[model samples]
Target chain A: MSAAATLIAAALGIAAASVLALVSFPARSVLVVAVNALLGLPPVVIGLVFYLLLSHSGPLGWLDLLFSPAAMVAAQAALAAPIICALVHRSLERSWAEFGPPLRILGASRLRALPVLLGMNRRAIATAILAGFGRCLSEVGAVLMVGGNIAGHTRSLTTSVVLQTSMGNLETALLLGLVLVGVSVAVSAGGIALGGARL
Target chain B: MRKLSLSLAVLLALGGAAQAESIVLASTTSVDNSGLLAKILPVFTKATGIEVKVIAQGTGQALATAAHGDADLVLVHDPDAEAKFIAEGHGILKREIAWNDFLFVGPKSDPAGIAGTHDAVAALAAISSKHAAFVTRGDTSGTDAAEKRLWKKAGINPAGADWYRDIGGGMGAALNAAAAMNAMVFTDRGTWLSFQNKRDLVALVEGDASFINRYDVIQLNPVLHPNVKIEPARKLAEWLAGPDGQREIGAVAQGGEQLFHPDADKVYVPGT
Candidate 1:
């Protein structure tokens, strides 16, 4: 339950951050530095921020989503956003530098040139997504805090590994660790296929 | 963008209703690590057909979770925190479900020579004087609070002592660190009994009257979380205070040692 939710969260976060990075690339100098700094936002800090936000007395307490899978999703997304944004922004900047002059010479507007630039660097974006997804998969601190690690409800692979290890269920922890490795392999393999399969 | 948000909304709605027949119980790791919940909750489910999903954390974190409106009920061992939870109107009431005691475990060599002493304070003092290795769980947990109280009573501040190691983790991790360092650790009887890897550690001091540990179950106030499963939460709390629950708890043993004694009838009122 938590694994799937985190994946969704990572995807959504990556998409949003990547879009903003791509669209605002040429216009904002300060945002570039800010995005770079945000790449180091520790997972635990992200979890704490979300915990404060989703707590009963928090501003978004009306949503009442704490300890739910949705909250875990939100936490993972927050944790992954900065990494995706910074990396995708850097990759998009490089592509723009490489393709900008020729595209402009061909009378391609910035709006029309954006998709071509994205296509030119599809592999880098795919790799960035894979790295962001890996970050989401291995994250334990943030998701554990926000999701509450409830059994059959919000427990994810990483949290389950921690729980099982602490409960003296070493074999169960090892098993879950293996499952995490397998899932990562599958996701990265699929990412490789998608990256190579298209423009 | 529209499709993504729409799917996310559907997923959240589905997750909310996924466990309608179940209730989320946030309890301490001591109880779960003892394997008592596995022994007792199944019987409750069989009788009531209401599945109980448990999230085992420290007492402080468990109460925090309940206060956040994420948990339907909480089973924890910190009385002061539990009281504050109720005083803040987060919970209905606190019911004592079971009781245990804390024990000091250390290297079997007994380097501090505090073994066989029934006084934890004296044992702590002796350990401090000797500068013997000691491991502490410093995560603001119930066990951590108890250790702090003992340290205060002993009039000793071993925080920066080279012999003292404070690892901010759960009970199991503390025990593991104790075993690895062959140091002294204060632990609940439940986790101590169920722990499989002892290494060079042994229970050095016990039987302190001040070491009594009590467990309580508190149902969150329905008004605080309108969507909480109050009916099942109340049912589970009542059942735990009743005969079958007590019997199952008492029946669970580790290495021929009973981990907890049920005293709900004597100490806790069921419905209040």
Candidate 2:
């Protein structure tokens, strides 16, 4: 359940970033920089804001999503958005600069050239999305705060690792930590493969 | 964007509806780690068919969560925090459910040589004087509060001492840190009874009148959160403070040592 939610969050982040990059706004450079800065946003801050927003006394509490898988998804998405946005946007901007004028000289419109640039950089875009996936997989603080770490319900690998380590179950905690590291390494390997893929 | 958000909202609502029969209980990690809830909650669920979704945090966090109306009920051991919560109109019908005691556990070598002492303050003073390593739960928990009280009583400022370390974690974590460092730690008897990784540490100071730990249950005020599952939450609270629940609590013993004594029917006076 946690893995699926993480994937969904990464996908949303990639989609939003791609759309933003395709649009030519006057403040595009500032927006890109802002997104890059947001990449460094701490996970606990995201968790705190979400906890307040989702708490029953908060404004959005009417949605009743506190300590649920949906809240976990929200946290992961918030944490992933900056990474995906900054990486994808940078790649898209660079590719557009390289491919734009040539396509224009060929009498192609900007709208027609957009998909060409995206397709040309699909591998890099995939790499960026997978990098976001790796971040989501390894995150603990945000998810633990929003999901409440309820066993058999909201508990994820990283949260369980924290709980076990704190409870003197070093063996179990180390095993979970190794599993997380293995999964993230696998994801990074896939990203490397995609980056090396022939477009 | 609107379409995506709308679909996500619908999905979350559906998931929430499926859990309509469950109650969200904000509680402390000490209670959860004691293994007492593991024994009692199952029976309550089996008999009542109500699912309990427990969010085990520190006593302070549990009370704060309940105050925010995110929880249907709360169980914690900090009497001052509970009183403040009820006074703020976030809770109602506070019931004293059970009782335990706190003690100092340290290395078997007894570096401070205060083992088997009935004076908690004297033990802490000895530990400070000997410059022995001491792990503190520093997380604003009930046990942490008691530890601070003992330090105040001892009239020593060990905060910056090289021998004192605050781990800012739960009871189990502090115990684990102490085990790893061969340090001394203050913990409630319930978590100590169920803790499996004793390693080289043994209970040092206990049987002190000032070391009593009392637990209480409170339902989130229905007026504050009208949408809370008041009926089931109140039912669970009543069950926890009733004869059956007290019996279950008393029955939970680790290695033939009782972790908590049933005290639901007894009148609890603060600071007694």
Q: What is the DockQ of each candidate?
A: 0.44, 0.46
lDDT against the true structure, per candidate, is 0.82, 0.83
Error of 1 at B129 (Å): 1.5
What docking grade applies to model 2?
acceptable
B1-272: candidate 1 lDDT, tens digit per residue: 66467647756775576446887889888998778897899999999999888888888988887887777889998877777888888887667889999999999899899989999889999999999999999877788889989999999999988999999889988987898899999999999999877778889999999999999888888887887789999999989988888888889899999999997864432345
* Candidate 1 wrong stretches, greater than 4 Å: A1-27, A104-109, A193-199, B6-10, B222-228, B267-272
Instruction: Estimate the lDDT of model 2.
Output: 0.83
Question: Using TM-score as the measure, which candidate wins?
Answer: 2
- What CAPRI grade goes to candidate 1? acceptable
In model 1, what is the error at residue B192, expressed in angstroms? 1.1
lDDT of 1: 0.82
Interface RMSD of 2: 3.0
- Which candidate achieves the best lDDT against the true structure? 2
